[model samples]
Target chain A: MTADRPRTSLLGTTALLFEAPGETTLETQRRIWAVAHEAAGFPGVREAVPGMNNLMLVFVEPPRRPEEIEQRLLELWNVVAPLPIAGRCIDLPVAYGGEAGPHMADVIEHTGMSVDEIVERHSAPTYIVFALGSHPGYCYLGGMDARIATPRRKVPVLKIPRGAVSIGGSQTGVSASDGPSGWNTIGSTQIAFFDVNRSPPALLQPGDSIRFKVARVLR
Target chain B: MIKILSVGALATVQDLGRTGGLSLGVGTSGAMDPLALAAGNILLRNQENTAAVEVPVFPFKVRFERSTVFAVTGADCAGRLDEAPVLPWWAHRAEAGQVLSLSHPKQTTWRATRAYLCIADGVDVPAVLGSRSTQLRGSFGGYEGRPLRDGDELPTGRSNGRAVPGFGLVPPGLALPLEADGVPAVRVLPAAEYDCFTNSSQDALWSTGWKITAQSDRYGYRLSGRELNPLRPLELRSHGIVPGVIQVPHGGQPIIQMRDAQPSGGYPKIGTVIEADLWRLGQAPIGSNVRFIRCSWDEALGASADIRRWLANSRRLVELHCGERGGR
Candidate 1:
């Protein structure tokens, strides 16, 4: 599907932003990826980073006129199609409940689903990786069952461990590193999300897919 | 080689920063005051991107294992080499086994924090992902991926012996002189979400002075100033953010992302402190109040050009000074 006219603006003197039409949807993200991939080849364009319903164009040789780049991006957005590519499937092992899932009880209280029911619903869908942001290798996944959605904690936890599988207001994903977070930690995973030594440090990419499997229950 | 005698609060080896990696979700981690790093390198006739020790805390002590020429730039932390006072921003040679101690930063001609200790050869830490800078968040790169501590021996690169002792260039702050409205301020360009805030919020951003809270660090500068209320409550999705983007969170206070900030954030960005003036903000001490001046796109780029011109001119003068045989 062709994208609507994006709201173009300068991110700063260095980069320009193009906000795609519609909310954070798979179609919008796919279109953003297509344009971002194409924009990378544009003159003076250093990197084109895809965000939730937006595309940030970082310039290496920041153009004399930023508006020119904005105009070009606007043109690309209106004409670019959803160029879908084959993505790899990776299963992440999770230990749910108890200490492993420190806030699993909170999810239960909010969703009104038993531990077994929540786990089954959450792990059933093959979630699409929409984007990576907030933290390194922190996947922004799509396809979570709305029934399992939970609001972010009022106060963020100071030091959440790496590979933390959590839910935050209609979204569920894994944390790549040990850092502060506001997501309700309902489970923990064993997958290594980031490693600097690796070519692509983040184990998951924008086009990848993820499935969660119940490894064991933590007491 | 250099042996860390007694490290105070924090000291880390830093270079220009790890760029071209934001796509991999890795933020650029590097020296806070990049101009200081570049100036120190120029004085020692070393590559501009050479790694140097960025000492934030005071009373830091170190002993050189071998005789080497070095330069200390940035803050005027009263420095001494084996009981003899060594002027900051000047290149000096230290004898083997001699100790170098940097005391608390004194309020001098310039009020600033953090100092750069640059050796003749760059710090010989193995570069991770094409950079020697320490990425604190990921726990990788630069001297075992951590801060320097007492008794830590760091390796140094091979020097070409072109560096001359007993001379230094003027501090870049004096030479470059970046300010707005006659006070210590940084120039800013309107960002993507500039129009999202209320008119009063926009007015306060350009007019009111913001104090740099003690909570500031390499990741970001948390500023305390007038509460910036948006036209309406706006919840933005996490997007790609660069250093110097002024993000206002729920508290209405602004936080300017720095070199080590995460690659992305969800806070509403009212403006971006231009890349040229980021060095000025880097030198701004905690508890200091700074103002922001709004500028057009061309003006922001012009500021960056001014920086490049200053660097080029400074390098030429230093080269000519070092080329002389009997230079003071």
Candidate 2:
């Protein structure tokens, strides 16, 4: 194994996490997705969920020999290649600023940019889905412009409505459900990110790409 | 069928939890005290993962529309069937129109906050995403996807007619006791960023008693104690987190995620309360102080084994006792 190979840690006896070393990149995330696919089929493994650049393997039952599984994961990490998934590019029509986005002014204050400029930069890039988490159908997307990055709120909001598009630090994503959050909301989308009645509930998955379409600037 | 005459807040139908949905960001929303749920099911001869009503608040009242067997487990709620007192952790057959009332938890024997109402069969709710657990965030599953309210009626599954009344089992909390400095404690295993915290902070985590703040709930337990400062500020990318993960935000107060915790988070993790002991923590009352006992990987696994053994033994004993009694 290399000096900075992936590290493994236990998330209690319920699950174990395999975090890739170095910077978080699409390349590393792709590898994590690949590992997740392979690990999901392993004995005693219930689910292999891909995070930003990490993979958490939840156990159906706590393994008697966790070290053996760790060794196998280590060996698998060394040999497994990045598996690129053929994913769909979803277009999300977003209404930027105004009351829908309660924290647009905060983002403006932090980025020192005009509302129009902020909207343009935010929608410029087609973001890739790094993972689906936080709440049902919520996507952790990559490729947000660094210039628009804003620090999370010191105190998290008691509740943010679903479809609220927001940015936190270098990451950006849309809230899939109405719940508490600390991210700066910049816009709102009408797309239902998740529906339990639908097969494969989450609207987006790892490897999918999202394009933000300017529906109407509420500002 | 059972009609909710009076119900407290946050009472919902739950099974073993919704599993295999983490990748889609769906959390495992289920009973906080799963051990009590399991024991209740065992007493009534229901399936291990059968759905039950998890009652966190007190003075819950329900009327049996039909004669059915049921068991009340978890907190000793001083349940009464009509005017007859019903023993905690015992199976009983309720006649049609009989009202079952559970008062405030006495805390005489076990210091618990929640109670499980396990019917002979289970709560008949449509399983969404392969579980009957109430997904509060998504607003789906369980009884109309919400907590049981007054006048709400829930259908019970077809009873197998195997459950026999007049039998009881010891509560697992008493059978499997864990403590540190005479304070209730749960085992913890260091997590991914355990080394990032300063030595003193790490030491304090193991040594101090953290009070469960009023903010504690199914989502997470906000613990108040000595600040757990890291070696330096740390920023983490969002990742999958399970129940029992101890996350330290910028404020350094540790928040222990529970069953309804988001499927993912970005806060730095210092440790996780082993899953086997999550039931103990779940039953811990608000404002109560809980100690953390650092444990090795092997020891954590052993604790899990211990719980499994307890359940198995209890199930076997219940089966033997019920079999001896035969049909009443």
Best by DockQ: 2
User: What is the clash count for each candidate, in the order shown?
Assistant: 0, 0
lDDT of 2 at B141: 87
lDDT of 2 by residue, B1-328 (tens): 8999999899999998999899989999988999999999988888889999999998999999999999999999999999999999999999999999999999878899899999996899999989999999889989988888999999988986999999999998888899999999999999989999999999999999999999888999999999999898776777778999999887889899999999888788999999999999999999999999999988988898998999999889888998788752
TM-score of 1: 0.92
For each candidate, what TM-score against the reference? 0.92, 0.96
Report residue B81 deviation for candidate 2 (angstroms). Answer: 0.8
lDDT of 2 by residue, A45-117 (tens): 9999898888889999888888788889999988899988868998999999998788999999999999999
Candidate 2 achieves a global lDDT of 0.90
Worst 10 residues of 1 chain B by lDDT: B319-328
Per-residue accuracy of model 1 over B147-212 as CA lDDT, tens digit each: 888889999988748778888777867776755566689888888778888899999998888999
Clashing pairs in 1: none
Name the DockQ score for candidate 2.
Answer: 0.63
Every model's DockQ: 0.46, 0.63
Once fitted onto the true fold, the runs of candidate 2 whose alpha carbons sit more than 4 angstroms away are A1-3, A112-114, A216-219
Docking class of 1: acceptable
